[model samples]
Target: MVARDAQDNVSPRSSTTTVTTGAACGNPVCGVRQVTTDTDIPWGLVTLPDGSVLYNRRDAHDIIQLNPTTGVKTNLGTVPNVQSTDGEGGLLGLAISASFSSDRWLYIMHTSPSDNRVVRIRLENGRLNTASEQVLVSGIRRNKYHDGGRLRFGPDGKLYASTGDAQNGAYAQDRSALEGKVLRLNPDGTVPSDNPFGNYVWSYGHRNPQGLTFDSQGRLWEQEFGNSIMDETNLITRGGNYGWPACEGTSGTCGTAGFIAPVRTYPTAEGSCSGITIVRDALYVACARGARMYRAAISGSSLTNVQTYFSGTYGRLRTVEPAPDGGLWLTTTNQGDKDSTPNNSNERVLHVTLGN
Candidate 1:
């Protein structure tokens, strides 16, 4: 089967017919290989137990199933009422239920006409039943930019979603509002009983958090986009406040006001970290502006042995997901223009193997 470009306008490139490995990072030769080329602005990715890889395109507003080994894609269908407006806001995140085989349910986080929302859809016989869409959570503030869109199921069996400040900095400090916060919810969209605020708000004071994942110790870790100065990787805690407008990185009055400090920070020029994933004991973060993937050794909640791979090789890495084949699958956001690799063959997905 041939691969299709983002617009589905061109045929598959002959050069991508075979998997080619690049350089070595460690003992066994860590390398990156192209899986599928010419994808639209692919945002989120989730792999099922059956090795079915699913991802969503921000502008297309559609969830697609990709055959990892064959590079064949099937459009599962579009999420209803998605607003692919200006910067950042659109169909952003996707997550499959733990009981996917039994329930065949999938969840998507998207920017609707009015606000950002999480909706549930059923996949029957490998096709999305869009007519069966169920709105799980709604009313998240939306803007032309800063619509934080990362969703994941936590170790505790709860849905955790990250929301941006929607260009409104004050929303980070407003507990009554869902903007600029990590929200915890049941699969049915109800607030979890043990949530910090007795509502869906899990952790507050964030400025467009885009990465959410759980470590080996079952602790939540998030990567947030900061202003001009710093970008943060934080160990998220229940009821913890990550000082946002009042603070940029770790410089503001963090300790004094009970705000939790980030575990690590990077200059905006070095990293505009987006998606994060844990493979074995290492945490891999995909950076958009940095055009690289960062690998850090994870020992419980602490991170060390930091290094970078594929820097500028696969322009603007957006999302990274663990492949069922013991490798990592990443998506590039090189959709053209100033923020991405110009004149590239659309955005693509790359597979990388981390050598032991």
Candidate 2:
């Protein structure tokens, strides 16, 4: 993509580096290109099938397309009826229909005046072209924090939604509540007949799950935020309960009835993972306070190898999407929070090339 960093240069033969707390990474010649830099909070980065890039600016209420070849941006239009809460509302996640050619339909998870929900819209001619918007689902509790709003269609052609506990501890164990659970439904928002609970609910007991992606094998995986110290990347299974509120990480026993444990976890509190993407043979995870990108090699639904890159070049990196150059795209997020560093301007999109 566009930034000034040296990312376009990653080759299949590029060398790998292992990093830890207070460590440095990337080769002296590894190309990590900073396409552009600004102070706007970027919420998502999505690469269209044709290699074009679309992203959202959480604070600006704007969604724009970036020329993957160049760094230039094309403003699509403001997300209407958005409710950008003090720190964590507005637009969060985005996904395009599998039938993009005929449907040209786009889906977004955002907090509106009412609640956080997934809504669909027609993208005729690639503009917010019309006012045609349909609510796939609604009535999710919205708050200043803990609103899980990531939406992705799984390999089964069902809409998979990640919902946060809305900062309420009780919701995690309340199977009747939609919060703190992963819901699977048809494109129309109704519960699938085969769902374990026979409702939209698929899994429960979570705090605020941010990233969800199914591997090429159709196995579901997720990256979640911890209360403070721990962050997790989990392998999601049917009807599995990921303990939250009751148990933060692997620190304590799940007790009785059983709960699914994370496949891997990062003990470094600052390494708060915001998004996860599975491309080819690796799982790429983006960090917020950690300000770095991590790669985990998976083998048969397990993390086999792990590494980190870009130690601290960017501040609070948030989103990572497939890049046009067979690499990946990342965006910084330090500028969004009022509590961030003074005069923070590290916000921008960075393109990175991963080894084959």
Candidate 3:
């Protein structure tokens, strides 16, 4: 089920030899088709200007390039000093520079021996220059689980990173700590001059924020995992504190704690959301336990006309990336989930075409 990376590291499992196509269920706006059946726990995906796809496998700890048209996957190289431990810590999010074509700079968030960190590397001529790795940010604590690792570049050209509380609730409330916070940094790893905290910390009091994206208006949106009661989709604001342990969803003493409430909340059973992407004015959220994609109309910070797509059709959806052709590329995490079995075709990236 698992393929090997260029370094011979075990890649993710693929589903079948042939591509599988499926009709849109309930929602008539989009149809889905399996694009590549050759990925194992693909965590992050970013498309290049030339339509090439660069992705990362969580356990594999390597960056891979996939030819969108040919289905050819090339392992660029393994990121140095990555500790892919059990649970959620490992090589996670990947983001290319705004000037990737010229600078060839790429960034990744991963777990190190001590804590989770963000590192910048050079991608030269289709290969990753591992020796060029520069640790941009470090000292964020990590645990066997709850290492929130999602990286994205905001429209302002600043690097935005999400970090989990590492199961330490107090960290979410600690203004001096990096864990359980959203950070804003320059591409070179320095704190932005206008950061609200005078440091990298932007928003705080987040539990496990896995999804981050910018709307057309440049406002940042986040999707987070809740403890047991609820899951959340939030509008991230500068210096906004989202009540984490002090607040489960909208409950608890969040209002008194000056915590920002979520735009929408779902019961944990209905949503263990992971990745998110904005397309055609709708925010598409990928769910793991819910096994569905939730599309909501975005209006400022509020979500309306919330609709569900592919409910239970795909198991444990992970990354939902916008494709070059105005569609979406969705990766599933069924290989090791309790609801599904691992197969050669289990973990797959699906192309989704939205209708009018």
Q: lDDT winner among the candidates?
A: 3
Error of 1 at 79 (Å): 1.2
Off by over 4 Å in 3: 1-28, 337-345
Off by over 4 Å in 2: 1-30, 268-270, 338-346
Superposed Cα RMSD, model 2: 7.7
lDDT of 3 by residue, 1-356 (tens): 67653235787787867766765445424577877875457888999877889988787778889887888889898888988546778889999976887788889999998889999999997788988899999999989878889999999999999999999999998989998899999999999989998889999999999999988998899999999999999999999999888998888886765788899998988899999999878999999989999999998668999998889998889889899778899999876533111122358888898765
What TM-score number comes out for model 3?
A: 0.89
Candidate 1, 1-356: lDDT as tens digits? 46543234566556535566865567422777887875468888998766778888787678888888898988888778998556678888899877877787898999999999999999988788988889999999898878899999988889999999999999999998999999999998888888877889999999989999888788899999988989999999999899988888877766666788888898888799899988787888999999988989887667898888888988888898888666888998876412322123288888887787
Q: Which TM-score value belongs to model 1? A: 0.89
TM-score of each: 0.89, 0.87, 0.89
Write model 2 residue lDDT over 124-146, tens digit each, in one string: 77687548888877888887787
- Pairs that collide in candidate 3 are 12-40, 14-344, 14-345, 15-344, 15-345, 15-346, 16-345, 29-355
Q: Whole-model lDDT for model 1 versus the true structure? A: 0.85
